[model samples]
Target: MTEVRGRMWVRGEPADGFTFSAISDCLTSEDTLVWADIYDPDHDTLTALAEELKLNMWAVEDATAPNERTKATVYRTHTFFTVYAIQMLTAVGDSTSTLVKHRISAFVLPRGLITVRLPPVAGDDPGFGMDEVSQRFDELGGQQYGVGALVHGLLDVVVDGHFDAVQDLDDGIESLEDELFDEDGPKRGLQRRTFRYRKDLVELRRVVLPMREVVSAIKSRRLDAKTSPELNPLYDDLYDHVLRASEWTESLRDMVTTVFETNLSLQDARLNTVMKKLTGWAAIIAVPTAITGFYGQNVEYPGLNTVAGFVVSSALIVLLVAVLYVMFRKRDWL
Candidate 1:
């Protein structure tokens, strides 16, 4: 079922409950910031809201488009911004888990914010939504900025979600590194785990790298009064986080690749060591086989068919075998 999550904040406090259709009534002052959130709404619902809000039809179409890159677009009266919130990536129930990119498009008006969320149909939960974002607004009760503060809160939550995912990936990589050297840990799942981590890092980089440009555009374009001078510090902090998330993901990818290569090298070295032992033992055994075969020949040869000669040949075989065994063992080929 589709859900519409929204709130009206007046004078930095949440006003009484109001419907999305009555959004215009909420914009009573320069201090008012109206936020409306919808998830996977039908065409009729979106069309009605677009007409009600006077939003550009082209921006609405882009919002409803199936796939969108993280970007910011300017319109005559407002700006359209699209961003993503990361859900998670994990192993669940033998299926291929995915990195959930919860696409959220925003209509940044001078005094209002309208958001549309395109979440996966199933199992892509990161336990965050507009309710959480609205709380950030309410938490700042009695302090008023404008639409810029609200936009910063939204982007902050999204970027913070990516930060958490990056931290989780780092922990997984650390644990895998430990298990790589552990002798008793189960070895069967290491390959799958490493591959999943690498895949997730790639996906994360795709999502996070573009965010730097998105925020910078919003900060620089000064879309209407939405880019207030007071918001400079907050947006600057958010840009720093985006930079950190992108750099961390690349470093983690390199680490995972190194671990995977080192594991293969260790396996090959072990195989070579086993082969050396087998070859050394084969050489030691061939000495006895050659002496017995020569002695058992039907024709006469030296040291055959006589007790004294047989004893001397037997001693000769034992001495040669012992000498070879000592040499091989000294060379660590046993």
Candidate 2:
């Protein structure tokens, strides 16, 4: 399914009757800017659009290719790049959350910006919504700064989504930490949850870490007048978000690792305590066995075949067992 929608702004105000065919005419004026959003475009649609926009064929392929890494490539005519918007999915009754990636590729030109929204590789990911991006562009005064405002609005939404996903993962990790120490907490479940969280964090880091490079590539190219001086701080601020998200992801990876290792250590400690208690009980049992065995011998030194002897042997057994029980109890071995 191919869906195309866009608007043209002339002299910082929206121009009516905007269409793909009119892009060339709209760009004739230095003050005119275009923002086109294409969703799930097929090869035929892209090929035709590419012919019209003079987009690099390789860049078009990268846009539609499955699992393209987050990156930016500058061509002689324009800059092409890919980025992922993240969605964190947590199932009902699931202690851990899963990360879903939505691929958003774009071509940054001097007077126009074309964004491609691809379907998610898996899961029900609501890919990036360009309506919100459009609204954001307007909110940021895209009419005044031209393409720079549009680019900032687009990336601002993306980076904000990344922040939200990171926060979700952080919450999941904290919940897992709470479960780790609870005496009645899920024993086997804790291990499974930690593994799941670690896996999610890895996926998140893959999607997040590369954003720094992508954003930097945009700033360095400067692409004619795409970004004005007013938008520099905005992009810099967006870049900071990318950096913070990257660092937060790194920290989370380490945190989940520690949680996994700590779970193992706690299990080992519990096992040792169990073994010690068993050993104490075994030692207490051996005392009675040894005392009776001595009395049972055919030529026993004492306590043989007499009422008085029977009482004496029984007394010895009771006294020794009682003493051992008290000692073990005091040491928390019972």
Please state every model's RMSD to the true fold in angstroms. 2.8, 2.3
**Candidate 2 structure quality by residue, lDDT tens digits, 275-318:** 98999989888987997888878885754688998788778888
Superposed model 2: Cα runs more than 4 Å off: 92-97, 185-187, 224-227, 293-301
Worst lDDT window (10 residues) for model 1?
89-98
Root-mean-square deviation of Cα positions for candidate 1 versus the true structure, in angstroms:
2.8
Cα lDDT, all candidates: 0.79, 0.84
Cα lDDT tens digits for candidate 1, 1-334: 5688777777766676767777877765676668888887777889887887788888888888987788888777788989888876565722254567788899988788888877565653663467767777666442267777778888888998899888988898888899778876437778777788888888888888889888888777654344357778777888999999989888998999987887777778778988999999899899989988877889977656689887887898999999999999999999
User: For model 2, how many clashes?
Assistant: 0
How many residue pairs clash in each candidate at the backbone level? Answer: 0, 0
lDDT of 2 at 56: 97
lDDT of 2: 0.84
